[model samples]
Target: MKTYIYKIAALIVIATALHSCEDAIDLEPISDIGADGFYANADQVNLGIIGAYNSLQEKQFDEWVVTELRSDNTQLSFDNSQNANVPYRQLDQFVSNPLNEFTSSYWRASYKTIGLSNHVIEAIDVVEDATLAAQYEGEARFLRGHSLFNLVRLYGGVFIVTETVDASQARNLERKSIEEAYTVIIEDLEFAYNNLPDSYGSDQAGRATKWAAGLELGKALLTLGTSDSKVRAEIVLRDVVSSSGGRLLDNYEDVFDTNNEMNDEIFFAVRYQSGLVGLGAPFANLFSPRASENSVVFGGGDEFNVPTEGMESLYAANDPRAGVNFSTSWVDNVGNTNFERFISKYNSDFGNVDDAPNDWVISRYADAVLLLAETINENSGPTTEAVDLLNLVKNRANQPDAVATDVDTFFEFKLALEEERRKEFAFENHRWFDLVRNNRAVTVMNNHFATDFQYNDPDAPFFNTAPIQQFQTLLPIPQYEIDLNPSVAQNVGY
Candidate 1:
């Protein structure tokens, strides 16, 4: 079991204490002295902030599946239909309904975080210590930004709740436009960028920092896709790349090694630890190969987020990361060679399927560098600088450098960078957002559906016969949410 530095006990206690209220009004703080008496001092304010961070842990399970499985990079795999997990498969095939469990959980958990952050932000002023108050406010804003960013990216317009609200208020609220929601997300991230510290000690290692906020702010701006926003994103990204003290690990495999987790390369991640009561991830059982002979997770694989063979083929013949990322074959308990490809990026020896210590990475230095390259390429045609930035990530995997001089047009340069990003971050839950951010989601995914079905089907006739409907791009607001709140409306074509 890996030993994580952060004290997860506090997060667990806070999560349990607030579980009932979280399910009630999405999330509301549970206080011994009630909301009026809560946030009376620095300690209480910090506890409130911790309550917000716990939502991230709650959201991580669906977040990974939503971003990666919906894209071409991964699929839910099992030998038989009986073993198939439909909640994920429905999403994978773009036939998901508004009542899909994972989608519903994502919505509820995201708003839960936002609600807790609002509580902290609204109450932090009462603290007597100025420095402590600012810190709490900064952390709350960072989390609020994080929640809204994820929400807005998935569902275009969303309900923007900046202050704590009652059930009646929530039920009566209207959805904000994408532009309006982004405005608040940007403002919160800007506050966090300016107010947060550069780094924290070992005890507080998982908390937000200035560089984390800056990276997120830059990402948020780039998502806008405006020329001015891209230019501004470049400025923020350049500072993060040049001065944040974050760097790519020399060995590509080391990035996922629990021993080397939270390395200089990682800007922010949801921390986890094994050997604790309630602090371990489930990726081991979720991604492991489905084999009855295996010892872990009761000798069967849940088989979620399994990588596609096409994704495996994208890497160069010499790419070292492929070995660490995927298991093309595994030895069974009886020592038979079973050739079944499965995701291995989060693979580690664990006590059970439910208890994995691997931390889920949110952002890293390489993501910033790639986005900087994207912004640079968008602002101007392919430049030597842009190619060099792509090469930095490529070189770490011992891959050959990209030849950008021959790439004469902006579109061609973008395709090159897209290929690099797809290979670099295949199973890391960045592919869907990358395709959407570059405006290639429909075309790329449409073509992918054709090829993927043909590849997965025993007969070629299935290819292109089952196409994803265009309106399936953005997920529908959960039906439960709409039933709970009268003012909310579902996404078009749901």
Candidate 2:
């Protein structure tokens, strides 16, 4: 994230051989000058790669509704009765069905990125420079694998479309088992780790590096939770910590400073530029308090992914990241003070309505470091090394560092780790996945319903009690996807 190379490239980047559609996963246009003809030259192939990265910009706006909003870490700030807020309400309450529009849009945007990556993968073969072609494919695979990882986690078994296909073929294709899906994901990341460079030149600042791919691969291996996979994950992630040339920025706020963007702490981020050629982030405008409207963002804020009171309290007294994460109060147009707080991470770069230059971070060094500690704990148990890794993040937040005994046992260490992550990455969209991957989603969310839903939560009083069973942990397959292809069965209990 150090260099900002793309001021012009953020201009609507079309993959030379791309056939993308943002409506559905398998609905890419069947006819186009496919990858081979249009991206026959090396320069065109690079453009196709850049286009895949550009596709990620579209998903940043909606990714959190399914991720953070679904978790207890964030909630809809108010109990409003509007139609557009209904999907968010359903998700926050754990009653969202497959037809939830927010998840549907998220699904479409994810697949658009995946589809674009696939086109770039196929087109890379036309480039004569073999090394460059492999690097390009590695970047494409990292993006595709990253998207597939999200799809598999959100919806159970999703269609594994690695290539362009006609509607007929896509309709007939069956969803892969979670195991089968991960097989493809791990393979792609493995290829990425081998081929991607440890670092890129200034010309390609934010492109996926070997360290980024390794962290993601280590995460996939850890998610598998097999003994062999955990061992591999530890090895992979250890290498990232020791050799990646990335470090946690000392000042917590400096990490997200709008003007001081370049730093080694970022491993990979969905890059955004704000000149309004269609590639800026919308978190500032969309997630700010609606009351702040023209006073804060030029247009009104939607109050999406607003902080929960429980989430706000996670920060310790004088914790460094608290101010950077969110703001507690706002004065609306009529000067009414409200508790409907907004996230401040993306607030610094607000350019206009729906346009902010803040990039959405997907992978960062601290995430990897914490994950490394998790891998070590799972692979072996709580060790000195693991405790050190856990304390690194805490120390950065000005919280007291943990001693060996505090996290001496596996269960204690796990809980401590989760709490630290919750505080460190509250609105960055890590809470739900952390719970699910560690097998606590069902229990934690049910507790949220019983306690928070019944008491102080703002939106809780609006809806009936929504307790989730085991099956509810996995979202119902998007109703639109099932509607498009009758063979695509919905997840059980839909």
Clashes of each: 0, 1
lDDT of 2 by residue, 34-152 (tens): 55666667786677677667777767677888888888877775546545577788888778888888778777878777777787787776778889889999999998899999889
Find the 10 residues in a row with the least total lDDT in model 1: 458-467
Q: Which regions in candidate 2 have their CA more than 4 angstroms from the true location?
A: 1-24, 27-31, 82-84, 331-339, 453-461
**Deviation in Å, model 2, residue 39 alpha carbon:** 1.1
TM-score, model 1 to reference? 0.94
User: How do all models score by TM-score?
Assistant: 0.94, 0.93
| Per-residue alpha-carbon lDDT of candidate 1 for residues 1-494, written as tens digits (9 for 90 to 100) | 33343445656546555644432347555544555576676776777777677668788878877789888888777453723577887787787898898888888888888888988888887888777677779889999998999888998898898987766676777889999998999999989988888887766777888889999999999998888888989999999999999999898888889888778988888877765456677777778776634543433677777787787688877898888778777777777877777887876666755677788888899999998998898888688898899889989989878765645578888888888888877688888988888888888877887777533476433222356666777888888667877567789998
How close is each model in CA RMSD to the real structure? 2.4, 2.5
**Whole-model lDDT values for every prediction:** 0.79, 0.79
